[model samples]
Target chain A: MTMRSLTGTGMTEDGMDELLAQFLVEAPELAQQLAEALLALERMPGPGQALDAAFRHAHTLKGSVQLFDLPPLAGLLHAAEDLLGALRAGDRAPDAAALDALMAAAGAVEGWIMGLARDGAGIGLPAEAAALGARHEAALRALLDGPAVPAAAEPAAALAWLPALLAEAADPLAEARSGSQPVTALHYRPAADCFFLGDDPFGLLRRLPGLIALRVTPRAAWDLESFDPFACNLDFAALSTAAPEALRQHMRFVADQVEWAGVAAAEPPASPTVAATRDPGQRLLRVEAARIDGMMDMVAELVVAKTGLAGLAREAGGPATPLGRSLAARGAEIDRLVAGLHRAVLGLRLVPLAQAFRRLPRLARELSAQLGKPVALQIEGEEVEADKSVVDALAEPLLHLLRNALDHGVEPPEARRAAGKSEAGRITLSARRQGDQIQVTLEDDGAGLDTAKLRRVAGERGLLPPAELDALDEAAAMALIFRAGFSTAAAVTGISGRGVGMDAVRAAIEALGGRVSVASRPGQGTSFRLTLPRATVITRVVLLRLGEARFGVPIEAVAETLRLPEAAITRLAEGEAFVLRGRALPLLRLSDLLGLPAAPAGTERRILVTAGPAPCGIAVDGFAERLDVMLRPMGGLLAGLPGALGTALLGDGVVLVVLDLDELAGGAAAPLPEAALS
Target chain B: MSIALEDGRLRLAGDCGVEEAETFLSMLQQHPGLAVDLAEVAALHTALLQVLLAFRPPLAAAPGEPGLARLLLPLLGR
Candidate 1:
């Protein structure tokens, strides 16, 4: 097998490089989140968790990229970090236009990361970085400058300090003494929310590099009137002769908040210094996954061999056979130990869900911006774990849902305000496990679907009859959004007016063995919920037999399996029907759907009544086997055949096609008639 | 410095690659080897695993960090 094929999915030869790539993947998302949060803060004028979340995510990306020495990305994040830091400190939050600039800068940095990943080395980005720096400085200048400074002068003033500072700051004397010096400084401060971020103030202070001298001064000796130990009010001063650039680099993320001064001397001032050090001799020893797989194969062989030996020993049973008994016991223990080790080895490949969730806020915000709507997004259950490839595949379609919500579900500011709602709409995005499946829900509280408009659109498109459109209630009308060419927007916008988006979303969700459903109200907003299995390695299916042919049904949709007595099923005009628990369900036989022969006479029929929220049932001849196996979807002509979701290989080597129960049972429109059933 | 073989021990000298595997294996085939040194190897990849698996040789590992050893353990199981 090719090395790429053997290592399983998403394992990179260089983990740090992969992590750097992931950082790029995550940064754009964080930038987008900050924009949305800024919008929310502007509209609601209250402190919400989204801003803090956006800040933390950006901080995390900044930290990860810093480890890789990606200076430009680090610099952009540093500016954003400063803005968020100031906002967190109770300064007036950034305005809309400033937030828009930051969002664009965020996009640029993300694009840079992607560029770096695609190419092994990053391009010389000095010009682009300087331009972004100028833009950020201009915004900061505008924020700090009052009406006294004309708005256009803010950019000129921000640029004014650069040349003089750059030229005068270059000191050759200091550079000569240090052998080649750039800059150096010492910064000291008590950490903000140190207790919450999980750090001990004194311990962190003690660990500072290049400690020329250190002293911690207690802010309050404890007045009985007010003394909060948890509220750390301590400050420290340190004199470090490390290069100011080194000091600044170390303190980059928190540079703005901390107080620091440049050290004029090249050497330390009579204090111990921990010089920065790294051993470049280190190398990553690579291993082939197939070798591990081969080892596992041998272990399996050993298990089988031991089993045979134990069986032989049992067959030759005798009380005096202590050696045989000992061998058997030892073999059993070895088998258990090997199995445990195998599971641990497999677990090393699992990655956290944060990698996926980290990108959503930015995407949500960007989509909202492009569609010209205000959306406040709240993401929960971000700590869920899954395989990395699955997470990568999830980004595009989830992003599409975000765009769909902003483009279609959310009403504009005037519409929301007129409906007695806050001008900024809310989108709550969450994921949690329901049974064996992960359920991701994207919900928006905007102007919900107008059933009348949906009816008119459906009638005009000739997708649904005017009578049928009239019959559809709010929930059913919203379902039309998933139909191909079913957009409700009056004019084509960049985001979703083409009408081809949601159909693709449906296909993508279903392709992953998941189902997507929409629920909406006229004035209350809309929600799209998707449920998918945790892993695609092995699929669990419910097997049904028709004549000699047996097919599999996904267990997710099988509500209940039953042995239907003849009296329970009642026939209706042009079709069969069954009344169960006060609801009339239309019955379609699996044999008829598959064009298979009928079952023999005098045999009791077994029917599996499958339905989702919309109840229906399918009658089949007999119950066969429910098996778990590796599933591969049939390609070419067989894939287009009605009702088959995918096919799996049964242990007996027979190929069983898995039926999509919802598509088959939800409607009475059978593609094949009894004449076609042979 | 690159990886080399000495006294039945695989001494990893200047980071050499799998193109040299045949010569190393032929030498090993003539004299069954055990110990291996990774001191000189700057990096290793899947090709080394393929070589080790091809020979099914038990490795008597020289000094290295646990991470290096852990990465090689599966292939060494052969």
Candidate 2:
């Protein structure tokens, strides 16, 4: 038991930090490039330069995985390299199955890299990861030892199976074809004694992706009187949105028993990552994102230091003297230099939204199959750049919106045609740089929100009273869907309609200093536009004193501050309220909110009004200077405390607790439950 | 017995194994309108589930388990 504690030894060992950090930075880029190389190889008639490059990248990745002492990941990577080596040696052609194995192996390594980034050397790879690694390794090894990737099936054999599956799964396959993109049809028959061998064939069939249709039939006519329950006598066939290559990869181990038919040529992958890999800057140096952030913090320090020197020159000899004038000139020079350096470092933090768009293509494919409404996603301005933190945080909200577009907005094929619209739906995602802000637009050409329906659902769910529903205008009524617990899904799906609805998406965008709005034209489409800061540069925070401690509140959240006479504040039964502009506004004492002792009776203090939902006045003892500083998110022992955004450092090296006005005003005074972190 | 008759419904709770399939089949045959409830089951063996699939008995309650529902829902014509 004590030996498990010794695992910390890996982190503290000299030089491991730099080594692990470098590994984290280089591995993901390398894996990305390798995936591109594999894609090229898959599309080629015969491998050439791409195969050699892929082999080299796989070799490099395996070495990097081994450096972190992750043997299982290394082993999986090694098998993939071995298969690539065989292809290079002309021992085997690069078949779809082998390429599938290699691509999946690369994806698996990417996941491992993420875990390592989160926990560093303290992470022991999960048992599930090890099992997945073993399976990938086994499949690759078998490919190396077995015959070449199976040949394309005969046309006559396909005819025998295709009609049966369609007939069996008629309803499921009806809306499956929205356009000419392509569909993969498969027939899989397990061994006769598979059940005795502990293989539930139906279980594997159930896991198929985009499984629009599936049918099970007895291989030989079932003789009920003589039937044996334990004997596996069934044949399974399915139709899916998965591509032919993906289907081959999924059924790799059972390839001999499976037959793939009716597969159209696959469309070129529309992933931004694939385009990013072909980038001309392949030789660009890789640097860790954290190191670039640290540089930004240092730039802030230099600016502060330069400002302090100006005050010193005044005390020494007023600005007219030679010493004072020379000091002033030097300070001006330093200021110019610092501004240039700031821009250069901030440039390092600007990453294209491309990386965030990688999973989008796969998402659209799966959704198309599930809803039986084909959606074509047109992405524009992926080259638009934003702060790396902003790029990363926007992924989930964007995914939720995309899911919502497909799940509820898009109509089934027949319905769209009946409405005099195109059979296939189109979703356009566009990004642009608007001065200091980035505007992202998601527009789907589908059935737009029905304002009347929205109002009815809101009233039916008791989220609003009949009077309020009747009084609201169309825009406000449409916005009701953003309220938590509001859902229009006829039945809950595991995707967009899961309990976490549009409200979570709005909260996330707002937390990043962004605003989201929705507009729709009934029968035309629905569009969502989100405007976010290009970067949250140098947070301007107003410092206030609470019980001998100073806390910072983001200046954007503070509406105004005033020194009020004792006669102004009125006591109410609930707590306190102040009359402002002929209206009553709630007032909460900072000390009371933080659960600290009350101020002495008749002590004079200033009031800070917050400019958001539940507009309120917060009374605190006093206020200090408003300054721009780098805010670091809460970590270690201070982590998970309610209403805490992060911390900023003051000149005296004191930590100024930054408050999230939204969390505080919303009244979540307790720490978040542990389960919410995941 | 993992398959217990409760009120008019057969409650398939906990783990129902292969040995229980015959008794389940007998119960289905005897009660023409028999429905199975899976709200409390933890791990249901394939043989017992196969019986339910073959008979297409009305489900009083679907399994609280997601994997069970995900695997068997489409097959039950839902």
Candidate 3:
């Protein structure tokens, strides 16, 4: 009989690729933790939990780093691990310089992690950077100044696994005796926290050429209630025809977990299979977004197919007929199942906002160091969940907001004392889920936006005329920061004012069908709030008709829909205007926006009012049912069409183009917003 | 549901991941006499396998993957 592939999961199973992918995802998190924890430990005195955690992160990082071919990275981590071990052992007192060196090492590793993500081996990182790792190693080693103190993990006692494995694969073992290769036996009990360290038990064995027999068993009984899907719980025992050195070399990463019972000839045996042993695990599986998106596409197709099944069934026979009834029942079952499947597939794409928040603390540390402005960043509700795409897209805008806070909104430590505020400025990044939306706000305690300066900047930059700038209220003036080419900073720093303005940040958030608004009270500092959908695939859109052509716009973009009398709308040379809530709101005819003939006039005009960077209203003929649709971004020749969000396939077999309200609300060439309040 | 008990026959299809293990166990415990059908199971996670090992429900059909079936059938004493 053919031996099992030994590669767990067997689907495109390049064990190295999977392990590297896992490492790339997990290591940066470790690096961030290592930096943050050490930085915290330095500020706090005595041996506390953070010290232990710092050591654990460093030790865990080293374990994963040593397995790869990058000697410099591995060496630097090795030295850091030893220093941490010494600190944990109370062999030496923790000092700021040592902590600083360790933090620098963490920073280097964090940088290398990005390069590692691009390529499993070395990416095109500069040679000096790799050499810098060695230098960090030398610096850390000098700080360490002793024989490495190895914090060996206690060996897992797995006596029953081998005998069970031998019993299960006894026949394969006897059959393999005829083979010439020197067989070796090993009981690989991976560290319980291996998954956290990116260790795949069977993945480590993928390199072993010959696997005559194998068996997987749990290290302990499964506790039904406490089963952690992220923790590594399985013990793998295998008999391979490969030499002991080769087996040991491949298992080097997890050398502690393995008990080498050499010479398989002396033993009674185990071809292999996958997924023999595992803990329900503590960590979530990192799936490529493309995989889930592909599944979503299939599920969408299923949705379309299932919608027509009843019609086809009714055509075959009347609903009263047994055949028709059976078909209808089957169709109903498919509907429920498809709906459940859709939810499940969407759930796979739901990642905690922590994914976006993890990197920001490191950024705060770096920026705080760079500016010499002591700022305390407090993040709350990071456990809030959002779609992977949405969470991934959030980092850019969030980073910019944070940088803007530290650089501009937050006052320097001495300056804060002069303002009677605490010496250390506080910036809070809070997130919360509100119905179908996730609102993330970054608030900083610094000299708040100077509306006077904002208006002056607006006037000088030609973003708006001085008359219009003066007409804006305090809140309206604060919103000018998001206007194209608006920056109040007198001098450009390496951070927020690096050519890209707040307008880019606004665009990024709006492109995701989200809203970004700023609020400030001069000396109290600024708060930027971003309201984004919890998921991207199934966006809620209001379907409306303009001159017989139906269109859809994301509901989040439409602040409110109203009916206005023709007398309310006064025609201007630029376009049209209507007064609402004591403010002049620019109104655009939807037909005119889409270049279609105007809708026949009615006593009352149906208007879709949007709250965006430039608030405006679009007049439409009629409104239809709001739907949650899978929005496919414009492709082929239709790409980059302004005001078009994407297309959605309706149940009636029509493709509805969802409008990008923000883009439509603020296009220079578009008829919209020329008469806008400016 | 990837793991379903229909008419006392528990069926697992496609890829049975660890996420389903908790429900699979509860269902196994709830219906003690439910036989299993892994005929369409493309891949089985270790958590589900351990649960199967603990329960040892009678098999309605051998696993679809030959390699998996070979190792699992005997362990289940089928």
Candidate 4:
């Protein structure tokens, strides 16, 4: 249940090294856990559990630092232990003051650990680290000397006798109520080089608040003669009834790297304790990711089979037949069961969005600082969940947009103040879900896109005619920013305004089955909202026919499908245009966009119109059917076609090309012959 | 947070603002051994002051003799 498993185990060199490496890796994670726990504790101050976590964290940090004579690390850790010790005593509560100091000290210790890990360097504490320690040490001296803090003294005594008493508790209710209860299990793995960082994992765990159990095992076992004392290869796990939160806070300095999770009452794990094992380093289970993947693959097959059965049952004559009725009923039941299982299987791939959110602040800060503008990035909705694939593809474009906002949307601090804004411009990055889509919006408070400047830049980039730039509406003009090689910056800097352009950002999002739109006011800040499909499994498309070929058009791009009379068609200098209620709409035949043979249009052909800065109509030979289907991207040479999103294999086994309206709407820069296009 | 020096320690009490923490941390530079009194401290914000404390002074910049430097280096040095 705790470190007791390794009690009699002889330590080995290799085991010790592995244990130390694990600790080095876990320290930062523990620190992060502490931060989160402390934040939670502030919200729910009555939780005794937070105090316990703080104690454990400090206990671990202190213990690990002791093995090596890393004097500086030990001193700070010792101070943190004392402070957390006071809080656990219940005589002194963890107020914001103590928490801040504790967190700061933890961070310092983390830096020290990191420094040592990088090289065999000594932790050089900042003046404040020493000052803070002095402060905590003074407080600790006061508390240790004062009347016995009940919780602190109780743990000391209870831990001393907990092991013998917990084994003797016969009844569950009695066990729960007993002061000797083991409420938690702690796992500690100190890196082989832990001693170099002045960390002693064993000593730290030994000082835990309610040490009902303790054990030390090497990361890997080796002959005792070859056991390297300098190599911190031991890992320790302990069980105690002390609150988890307090233990977390006590070890917040290296919070980013440790992993901590609660142990269920039923999963004590029968591993030999530190004092019990002959060779404490041996591990019993090592589950490979590939094996889990194999299990998931089998589950997926079961789902597909269940779907087939349901389909077969629907085709059966009637439920009146006894066999048919039973089969149908079972089929329906299996459908529901498989659906639930499918969700659970898919859930395994969902990860918290916080993984990406953490990297944003520093990025925002750096861009803002580089631009001589003060921009604060406000991130929210971090708990939103998305598949790992989506999260992985999101990082870069988000960074690009952040850079774009700083480079173009925000003004210098002085400029901001002159415009009646705060010196620090605000850039907010937020994610929200609507239906089955996730929208990530980046908004800034600087002067919105300089339309005139954009127009000038567009003209310079040859994206627009200088003479007609003034005639273009704001939305249409703003869209120019997405054009390739577009840059409004007076001069290119290391950050942005390069040829990569917003087109790159648009391309990135589109690659993930998403679309990006910009909304802004001339003097107000601009907002870029990228709406992405939650997953790539299924796409919603409006199916239409061009002669004998059926094509799919994404629902997002289709504003409406109108059955227009031939009279609506009007000829323009550039090409054939259509007018519906006096608005001039450019028309691009679906056949022409797909490079398919143009079919003779019927008197009443359906025109699918798109919505954006520019609306375009695509005339199909006939209207087929609209269905949402799974679209597999076309590979090889066909992937380069901008107009084609992908292709789907329909139930009839016919391959239908999916149209990318956004790309088609980009208009003809180097148009092929009108006849050849179709 | 209310911070002042008492008995050679930087005595801190009351709720500490992140912005003000920076100023308080700067004060510690002149008085490195300043001890803080959190007994009456109501709140502490993990801002510039905390970050400053957490920021280990580079060993290359550590003062020659062992005093506060000695106390702090081991906690932060590699």
Candidate 5:
């Protein structure tokens, strides 16, 4: 039946679309979990929790897809659930063909979900899905009829090798044969260029949980003088008593390179016992990020209103009076409660970096294959938590960076070998929490930054004048890579030498109120470090007043607050400057910088020192109390304005325009006020 | 379906459906070196065939039915 006939019954088109979107986001994850569980069941067929999990995944998919009334898709999952139920009840054990059918059904459902996501809910299941459903139904019928004849046992050649290999490792194989657990014999012959694709045969072999025996042999005799270390010429055969699921999972990434079978001699365990452990309690709730962001905005508004209320209560009477004292006491209590509430809400927004890191290994593997460079990716500190917004925004930039590392940073195997390094290059992607910020660093051990080449390219591109380029130090010259249209590659390749440079990476991170930096040494390696805030819901700001309008500067950016007398300020040819601890700190007037009305300057003006590599002092008419305020990035026309970070509501109900100190300091080139020196 | 041990031969005849798979498998497992005679077999279910393939015993006589030979002989790589 057509999808429209099923889906358009009770729900509106918009409702269908919303549910489709949710299904698209959620169904694939469930389908993947189900696929893994089914593989586990195929390896160790028994009445157990694995079967239950597989059943639940299929059942959940059926229920969700049924919501949209996709008949074929839902029917496929239903058939799968029945097969699983039969397996769980000890009605039948799924042989190889049965497992294949189950996998095919799960895959068809996933494909339908993708189609729905791409074409909206109006899209119907393709004919292939119907065919797959029919196949699944047939398989289930056969299974229910009773255990079909198992496939022809292992091929004769494999059978012959099995005994010889077993004879070679008699003791362990004997022990393994005594157990009820099934034993899998695997023969893995990786691609000739598997090394280039970042396949670690040894590492994968070592991780087999119940390794019984392992043999590694050169596929052919090596010629001493003509040997190519870069090429993978090895064959690996292993016997592991590991659960079939574990073996399959370990080989999943390189499935094409391996052949595996369960030895017929290793029968199902005698008791066929189920695992005693129950499924772990699921503590996580899958909520849309936008909802959490909306809640955060509301909490910000409530905190502002609460602060306003406390201000009014304090103004109602002095602390000496009974009413004033009581209001003051209540206000303090509310302050504590609001702070606790704010923290609890902010905690909801934090997610682990692993969400983004998990997708990198595959990317590295694929890119390494494309570039013909073998790269070992080591990921560390994936458990570090950051704002969900930050994690979501990080994915694309991290992809670009990893692509760059694989393409440009990692040298070819021959080049690496010639340089006295291993033929396979290494890339390390690590994240760590330092104070309130998360530092994600990607380091590569290959050819480092060629500063001389970068400087030459920068000069040729006219990004900076020759004199300025000459004056730049090594670090500053290296920083030129972030300039737009900057590329140091001699020839453009499809992978990274596209016109888009590190400039885009920096721009994206900076847009998130974070900064990106690079450190590299010639002949060593390069590391890119991104420092981002742990959460974006609320920020501590130092409030300053210019004219009647108040503005908030992020407290992290404030170096020191001081009363700078007019006598101490000096006039420079460029603009106003002040000597703070023997360093010339550029001074900017906040009112002049933001193009706001200037309040009449009073003697001994308050100057807020902005901290960074280049510290700058901003003169304001007065200083207000510090606060933890919700900072929202400006929207609409104000979004284009320079030096405005976002807007925040204050205790007194005034909207504080938070300033972006980096932009303010960089753009302060207006003519100095001659009247200020008077 | 009938399975009998006669004259050191495991003889099978008639329809061997999935219900007879367990009995067929146990007989094959108990007598590791027994010869199989499928001369009078009518229909052989896949489950029973799977058990025969797993045991890999020597066949004493080819199936009387050409269709059974076509279905079962190549699987034994004869």
Candidate 6:
């Protein structure tokens, strides 16, 4: 079918873009809701309110699609609406075939929506959608004619007879077993109100891949005298040789209603697994990230202006005067309001880690299948929220870590058995909030890091000197795995071993003001922990003075500040050093680092100790009050300057340059002053 | 509006909908064992289907339309 143009729909190009953007954002959520409601309806089979809700969703989606001049998608949704409308109006009883048709329509619409997202609205509908639309129309017609084929005829009565069904499936199950396919028994008890959501449980059953045998029975005895046909009272048990992921995908919409177990050659295990139900009405709003960032910039500026106002209020009469007191009171009020505004804006950028965590299970499943290692993924604290930018940046690093775990950390089934562990290895991804930071840890219960091998690899790759490698402790040796060009993998695989795995993960995390650490036990497991700031808008910094200029250093980077007399300073071959509590720290003057005029003879100097793998002490003229400030990264001409974290405006209208200590400590070859050498 | 009761039998015609379900169910409740004749039922609504399934009265005659017969005959255990 030929696609219609936006112009023909009487929408301006910009307006069309706006509408399409909104549609792209909203259509997927609506489709998901419809699918969930439909699955619920199938389980329960006839809730009037659910039917109405399903109908409304279909109708609204159709209207939206039609407004964009997409006839095929609109038509598909329209057919679904007709079916749902019929059920809602009580003009047609809920039936499997009808629901199947509606499901097909919904799927077709979903495809079109995805297509629109990938290729613009100008893209034409595929032929499959046209076929689906035809089927939907036929199903609606059949429903209008009368009940369609007795709704696939409920399975023969008596759960006890399931043994017979198993016998019938024996041949196919045997074939699956012989072919080395995993066979599983599935028990599905849809929500009782599934019909109201427009779900047909039998229809879903019919679509199960690699199906071998099936039995259907009511959870409770039906009372013919007072039977409510609309209420679903059915339970389905089936044997299938489909991959677990396929089964999971098929039942994702109604996950809470399914119990599945691996079927062995012997009697099938009777373990019952219940799916977790997510609250349906969790409120969410989608706003453009750029808009939020814009608002944040404004808030930062407002904070700076408020600080300037407070300074002015102080200068007006000093706190002792009545005028000064009133000004101070109002200034305090504005400060509180601005603080609240800053928090609210920052919260707008917070997103749950589940956004990235949801994709890992599928990845683990696929990788395990490919590598011939059965790995089960366990996720926890997925609901922990972090900055959206951080979450987006996290996906790649996490993927790399998981791939590394699957390829090298996890052992094959036979090997795991020999090791006295379950044949199925486990990889767990968990997140937790600690203070103002979110820590995400990925751990695998498999062959842990071989520290000896790591040390040898590090030495072989020249990552560490031979003597240093010999003196490395277990933790220090494990840290060698993150060094660039160091890999312990005996043979490189496409998944993870070009000698560039953990280092990249560390780099990505550290780029977000976070840190990565590794801990492993020889035969037990290995874990990578990433701790990142919850948000990056406002930062706490310890203000410092260098000559007449002021600077700021992040509090996280500052381990402690010490007042050192001139006598405590010691000279090293490369630079100045200071002894604090028996430990000598390499010290660099802030004035020398930034090329500012040296401080005049000082009464006393303060040293700000920085923390990291290698600690350093930065000597400054004096320490100023530590305060919270919105740090904005330098733009344009100063954007790429090394050692500059960002700049923040002080209360007295001075711009305090925040130093990136990591970069400054690591980068010292630019220029040297003769005074520092002496 | 598309249904009428005559001679102790419920005769249904045209399209029966949710609007008609309560009255039909009340009628069936009032007169148990009443037979149903659907010679003219062009369409059946879910509410009416509920009434029929719950009441399960004997059908005076099978639905005239083959499509309709295919739907209702097995359901009625004919």
RMSD to the true structure for each prediction, in A, is: 20.0, 28.4, 17.7, 23.9, 21.7, 18.1
User: In each prediction, how many residue pairs overlap at the backbone (N, C-alpha, C within less than 3 A)?
Assistant: 17, 0, 12, 112, 2, 19
Docking class of 2: incorrect
Instruction: List TM-score per model, in order.
Output: 0.47, 0.58, 0.60, 0.45, 0.56, 0.55
What level of docking quality does candidate 5 show? incorrect
Writing each residue's lDDT as its tens digit, candidate 1 over A334-397 gives 6677556544543443444445655666666667667667777765444445544445556777
- Estimate how well candidate 2 is docked, as a DockQ score: 0.08
Evaluate every candidate with DockQ and list the scores: 0.01, 0.08, 0.09, 0.01, 0.01, 0.05
TM-score of 1: 0.47
The alpha-carbon deviation from the true structure for residue A249 of candidate 5, after best TM-score superposition, in angstroms, is 33
Range of the 10 consecutive residues with the lowest summed lDDT in candidate 3 chain B: B68-77
Measured as a fraction from 0 to 1, the native contacts recovered by model 6 come to 0.05
Query: Tens digit of lDDT per residue, candidate 5, span A46-113?
Result: 55545777898899988887886566777777788888887766666666666777876766666677
| Superposed Cα deviation of residue A48, candidate 2 (Å) | 11
**In model 3 chain A, which range of ten residues has the least summed lDDT?**
A268-277
lDDT of 3: 0.74
Location of the lowest summed lDDT over 10 successive residues in candidate 4 chain A: A267-276
Candidate 3, after superposition: displacement of residue A505 in Å? 2.2
DockQ head-to-head 3 vs 4, winner: 3
TM-scores of chain A in all candidate models: 0.50, 0.63, 0.65, 0.49, 0.61, 0.60
For A1-678, candidate 4 gives per-residue lDDT tens digits of 113221113556467556655555555555544444444344334325456666677777778666544455567677777767777666566666666566566556666566544442223334455565666455444544334333432323313323322232212212332233446644555555655565545445545665554443345654333323355554455555678886666545434433454433421111111012112136634343366446555554564355456456656755757766777899889867766765665566555555555446656655765777876666544445665556667888888888888887888888888888898888877776666678888999878987778888888777766766778898878888877778777778788766677888877677667788898986689999988766545456788877777788878778988988887677656777767566666777877766779877667668888866677788887676565455544556774557777776565556678878878766642232334222
- Estimate, for each residue in A1-678, the C-alpha lDDT of model 2 and write its tens digit: 122331334566556666766776677777766765676576552445567778888999988777666767789889989999888776676777777787788778767766666565566666687789999899888889645534433226344666556545433332343233466788888887666666656656666766677776667765545445666667778888877777787787778889887643222332222344335465777676778878977887765566676776787685879888888888789878977887788788888876676566557756887879988876655667888878888898899999999888888899999999999998887777789788998999999999999998888899878987998898888888887679877688978877878877776676566778899999999999989877755677999987688899999889999888877877655666676676567778888877888777564558898886557788998898777676655657875566677776766667778888766765622222233212
lDDT of 6 by residue, A1-678 (tens): 333463245777778778877887778756755654564465446634346557878888877777766566676677678778777665577777666666656666666677766675566566576666676666655666555333333333323434434544544554565455778777788777776776666656656887766666556765656756566676777888888899999988888888876665432111011011122335655667899988976787787677665667778886888888888899889989988998898788888776666446556756887899998776656557888877877888898889999998999999899999999998878777788899999999989999888988888888867987999899989998777677677788877875567877876676666789999987899999999888876778888887777789889989899998877787667777776676666788877877777777576678888877667788888888777788765556775566777777665667788888877776552223434434
Show model 3 residue runs off by greater than 4 Å.
A1-22, A120-125, A145-286, A303-339, A537-551, A555-572, A575-628, A632-657, A666-678, B1-78
| Cα lDDT for residue A101, candidate 5 | 77
